[model samples]
Target: MSRLWSPHIESMKREQIEEMQTELLKKQLNYVYHRAPFYQKLYKKSGVKPDDVKNINDLQKLPLTKTGDLQAEMKETGDEYSGRLCVPESELLAVYGPNQHPMPENPLITGITDSDRNTIIQHLARNLIMSGIYSGDTIQSLCWAWEPFNRVYMAANLLISPSVSEILGITPVTLEIIPLEAPRTFATARLLKPSLIIADIGHLTQLAAICQQNNISPEEIGYKTIILKEQRILSEKETKEVSEKWKAKVHNMLAVQDNMLYAEDCNIHNGLHIWEDAFIPEIVDEETGEKVGEGEAGKLAITNLFAKGNPMIRYLINITAKIEKTPCNCGRTHSRLKPQ
Candidate 1:
């Protein structure tokens, strides 16, 4: 049977998904327009108000926010957050940026309130469950530690590891993957005998080579699943090669760093299912900024519907992908993104 963290939301009907998205989008737009100076200026300049967006379809009326726009705003205003921060400095719980260590001059800093952090954790838990994590399963995470560089990567340790341990009764072994620490990592893996491994393809590739050199087999390690922290789609050959080498089910996890968005592949491995309830995704033509048809490849744009701090509206993420609205074999009703 398919594992689900929030079955009702994950398997909701298309109509119900749309209704929830519409309600959340309207509230998010209103919240950003009134509280965030950057969004307020952008909407007023485009002659569109929050009320103009009556539903999800009406979101096209608002202008798109690009990375360049955010940079320009930061350059002009000298604000690190580019005026996208809705919460005050005191209310900010966590702040993330593009680099490992964000400087004061960084243009794209995202701050999250306590509520926003909880929302991220909730969705992240659902994604882990869908990726075949079960209670009592031990997870060995090779992602980065809880640092300022990438919140999603850090979530693998700080948020996901603890949450899964406390709530789902899973044991987590998180290790920061440094080149010199390869021996240590493998030694710990052998000792712990974790059921699942979470790491990027590069790390896995290196580990695989090391295993071969040491006359060790991945199958002997007894990990049943390997979750790849991938930003782009992997070719069929690559996926097959990795799965064969590791003798484990390989799952792709697409993490959009800018918006803190995550989409994970289920057991079927057809595509990465996006958590649409928290994010509004639009596949639009890069040149004309027009919406693309179903299953048509275009730039992936996302709007944060549940984030209370640094909410993004129609932010073009600069990734080409085709959005699939059909139901997944795993019974999830959320749309999937086949990233190109």
Candidate 2:
């Protein structure tokens, strides 16, 4: 009867979570410092060794890495990975670049080993469960697609959808969003009667309009849940409006494409819970690069605890967000991020 995917890990006490994070952080720091060329140079320049970071509290001592730094390194060195890859090339499972318009020639690329990919799938599975997805529920993913291919689709197709299908035992029906094929996609949805819909705001809005043009009620589609892949936080009014429009519960998700980090809102709608076991989230002042006061709004920084390929430590994601340490109504003890 429990909805949690990993109750023991999800319901851990705050202290227990911190203890686990400390252990993982130390291991990750040592792994990256020695293997990842980027981390080695950065730490050497900062005059801080991996052993200097004794605990989570000492994370600020590590220098912050910007996306621009990775891009510049790639451009200058002509190495696709920009020296962030810690694992050997033969061990790589997948590589992804930033999903931007006019994709940069020397874009920042992220590679993952088989272990790294599995860890990402596990985090995504946790997000799906937190967003009300359950076993036996059919998910219809309406994400973007293009000629050269979008990295978001690659994540959804190769990682997200497959995680739901295989790990969670949920049926997945992913469709590439083509303007002319809207009716056919809806027809398939109607035939399948999927219980959950996963898409971004733009695709969902388009689907709503298409349903209207066809004189179809979204409620009649019978999907009771809508998981949105959104970067910015949605307002209460906007969430309510979307839920009303689709007659489904709306859950917002924050997914960073570079490192495949994910966070999702629980039914309580408080904030997106970051998987602390896999990642360490920090909010620091953009100008000072110092930790802000508790619950204070600042740029969001993330450190990958589970990544073995490209270990991102103290990487500022340029999003203004505050971290909430209080326990949630959903009973999960992981820290929540409230993006401004």
Candidate 3:
């Protein structure tokens, strides 16, 4: 089916997206500067006010937020929520601590307001549509690996599972394989005959290794599509190799623990289409903090448009990407990010 989860915004013109982002960015800055202490202090120190930022260009005036800022705030205040939370505990629907970089003493948890959580879920749904994943499709996803401590792929899958199943009515089959057990993974996939496979690059690589061991092609498993979620992009050679080996179409998606679904490739697979309604993406030089021209490579910066509890403004996501201002052949007007 040819459909967009949010047709109007997904098909918006480049100018329209920029205008919308400008409005959202202004509101977000004003909201966070007033409600979030960390942003308030940062903005004040940078001599930038909410009103000072009227458009995306004015974003250069605001200081970039680093992950260490949150940690430093937690260390000093002994309050995990002091820097990031805009609302009271009564208003928050969920609290999440970072799975990576564990600091037990001053562990900070981010509050997800009700609206924020819904935004995350809705964005994930949009990714499914953008990737050409449809309802009623059988999706085989990572469950638990043999090593219990390493559930990186499993955790990501679990996060989006509810939204996919509930909103799209898709059937999700999670595979839990014993450690060093390729046969088990192969068997599970064969039994399910999933049409779509959703997992991180590591898990998919492991499955590819299993395929070699058994002398069985991934195509024999019968999955038509594979979605590899990663913080970085795979090389074109690697992407082509995976598709050739598995006999399936491969799609890459960029996501982080902090932000759920940020960008995903359409069927054309040239670059990832930024979720324009949810995020305003910019490619910038990390040292100078200046916007890189279109088709230029630089660090990926994201501004969350609707996240109330934790507003991300000019936040450097610690990944490098090349921005493509040209429209995607798939008809999504959102800018494309080629993550490196």
Candidate 4:
């Protein structure tokens, strides 16, 4: 049986979801247009008024925001914010960049306001729920080196490293900085017997190989699910191999560096159901900048609805996807995307 974190919103009608998006988007556009010079310039150049975007369809008239635009802004203006700051600098609770690597001077930044932080936490909790993680389940996060994954476990107690005491007490471990090797990871898993393992596909593949070599069955380790945390799609061979080798269900989640977890696979494993309430997703043609047919593959464009401080309107995520509006058997009415 498929479990839902927020059944009401997850099963909300497509039309209703669009209605909510349109309402919030209008306010967001108006707010950014007046406060942020970056958006104001884009709006003025495109000859599109904030009020002109009345519905989701009208969003097509607006130009897509690219990473280069922000880069150029920072280079030209010497502003770390790239002119995307809707609220004052004092109001920002946190800031995020695109990767875990050490950034050069004046890198692109995504500011998080109090509202944005709250929304992110709420949505992240929901994503975990969809992944079948409950409050007491022992989770070992294997997403080593990623900084955003560290903040994703606010509700659940994430252990920095494996602890026999914590595992015996049924508490989870969140591995952020651990090395993705066999000896330490498998040793900890053998000791702690985690219920869920959060790692990308590559790490999981390595772990599975090590388990095979060490004559350790992943099922024997007591993990029920594996949440893959990177952008790449899982092949059928890899999925089956991991499922059989690890003896766990595999879920592919779609996330961005700045936005964190936005979409994830449910128990049904049809496609990654977008957190529509968090961001407005669009499948637009890369060159023409037009919306594609339903279920047709196109570039993924995201408008982070809850990002009030650093409004990302019509931002192209540089990933291709095919969106489906038809509700999945799992009960979520939000559109699903097969991101490539």
- Per residue, candidate 3 scores C-alpha lDDT tens digits across 142-246 of 533331112322223453333445677777666653345556667778787778877766677777778778888678888788887666766778778878878
Tens digit of lDDT per residue, candidate 1, span 1-340? 4888899889999999999999999899889889989998998998989899888898888888888889889999989889898888888877766633434454488887777766766776787787778878888877555432234322344543334355666777777765655666688888888988877777876777777778988677777898887667666677778799889988887766558687888888888888989998899976566798877888988988988878898989767888888899999989988866
Model 2 C-alpha lDDT per residue in residues 1-340, reported as the tens digit of each score? 2378888988899999999999999999999888888888889998999899889999999989888888788788788898888878888766766756678777888777767766766777777887777778887876555311223222345443444367787877777665665676678788998888777777777777778888988777777898887666667787898899888999987768676687888989898888888889999986667899987899999988888878799989868888998888898989999866
Write down the TM-score of every candidate: 0.91, 0.92, 0.87, 0.88
Per TM-score, what order, best first?
2, 1, 4, 3
Higher TM-score: candidate 1 or 3? 1
CA lDDT of each prediction against the hidden true structure:
0.78, 0.79, 0.72, 0.74
Error of 3 at 128 (Å): 1.4
Cα misplacement distance, residue 123 of candidate 4 (Å): 1.7
In candidate 4, position 9 carries an lDDT of 87
Residue pairs with clashing backbones, model 2: none
lDDT of 4 by residue, 178-249 (tens): 444645667788888777877777676667677788897767877899877776555557667778877788
Clashing pairs in model 3?
Answer: 146-179
How many residue pairs clash in all the candidates, one count each? Answer: 0, 0, 1, 1
In model 3, the runs with Cα more than 4 Å from the true position are 99-108, 143-162, 175-185, 212-215
Show the colliding residue pairs in model 1. none
Which residue pairs collide, candidate 4?
A: 159-174
Give the distance in Å from residue 34's predicted Cα in candidate 2 to where it truly belongs: 0.9
